[model samples]
Target: MPSRQKKVIFCIAGLLSFGCALSVAVAIGTQFWVKGTILCKTGAQLVNATGPELDKFVGEISYGLFHGQRVKQCGLGGRPFQFSFFPDLLEAIPASIHVSVILFSAVVIIFSLVAAAFFMYNAFGNPYETLHGPLGLYLWNFISCSCGCLVMILFASEVKLHRLSEKIANYKEGNFVYKTHSEEFDRSFWIILFCFTVHFLNILLIRVSGIQFPFQESKETDTSTGAADLMY
Candidate 1:
């Protein structure tokens, strides 16, 4: 590609990286990561609620990394409660896995910013051939993508394998046992997935900007050098 075309491609990738950074940041602070309903098992059993009658004993739950809100129901009515993860519910939940998810999310945001900066530098400035150059762009983007994937995987495990919703629903309940009726990842979780996709796309954009993959570039240079030596 021509120099002008390469600059444009780099600029586009930079914008995308910046966008991913902002999107993930917003998602992390939101309480829409997981949304579900919890059924009051004790109340339902006591009343032997069947069919639509079960709805009276079911309530909504939604949460994110930091804090969340849930509506509790036990055949009486819905009672709203708010919660936090840091010091409050840490014992009731998988603190290690939850913290790991948050850590990877922060990593994704930081590396995304780094990738965006590098993309802009590659587009408009003369960067060093080492960490500040095209290879660095690939490294940063790949890190961001990998971290995004980790965020999703770790969170999914925390929710599913660890039974996060049930734990939260029955956190302080003494007489009632709550069971998860339904659970699904919400928009905030999907935003991380979108960020992962954007970083992957940025990798392809780097290639489209006429930069060869690192190993391929080195192999081709070696082949050319060998051919020149043979001719000499």
Candidate 2:
């Protein structure tokens, strides 16, 4: 690749890495990972509510990894109640899985920033042998991609397979009891997915910048050596 093309590719990859980092950070901090409505099962049963009266027993819930809000619509006009995960709800499996998700997200952000820095360094600054070369780009981008994928997969499993929203809603406290009616991943979840996809795309961008796939390069080297030996 020409010097100008290399610069453009590296710059684009760097910008994408930064975007992934920002998206992961925002997704971690926001309470929009999962959004759904829950029914106040106990409340409905207590009042023997039926038909339209049951509508009053529904509540809105939205939460991320750390904190969230629950709006009680059980005839209370959507009074919001805030909740936290750490120390407060850590005992729950969903909370534990979410904590892991957050950890992986942090990993993704850290490695992505590192990759972006390396990209810029290779593009403009003087690069050394291993740390600032095509190998380094591959390494950093691979790590970021793996971590981002982990974040998405873990969160998705918690929500879809483990029924995270339902678990959180079903948690009871003294006289309070809740039941999940329906749940789905919200904007933050999709943002995380997008970030994962971006990191994977960055890997492709690195390859397009004239860096051979690491394994393929090694295979070619061995094949050349064998051919040379046969000629000798």
**lDDT scores of the candidates, listed in order:** 0.94, 0.84
Q: Give candidate 1 regions above 4 Å deviation.
A: 228-232
Off by over 4 Å in 2: 47-51, 94-96, 128-131, 228-232
> What TM-score quantifies how close candidate 2 is to the native fold?
0.89
lDDT of 2 by residue, 109-222 (tens): 898899989999989988876767877888988888888778878888988888777667665555657778888888998887787788788889888888888788889989
What's the CA error at residue 154 for candidate 1, in Å?
Answer: 0.6
Candidate 1: what lDDT? 0.94
Best model per lDDT: 1
Error of 2 at 48 (Å): 4.5
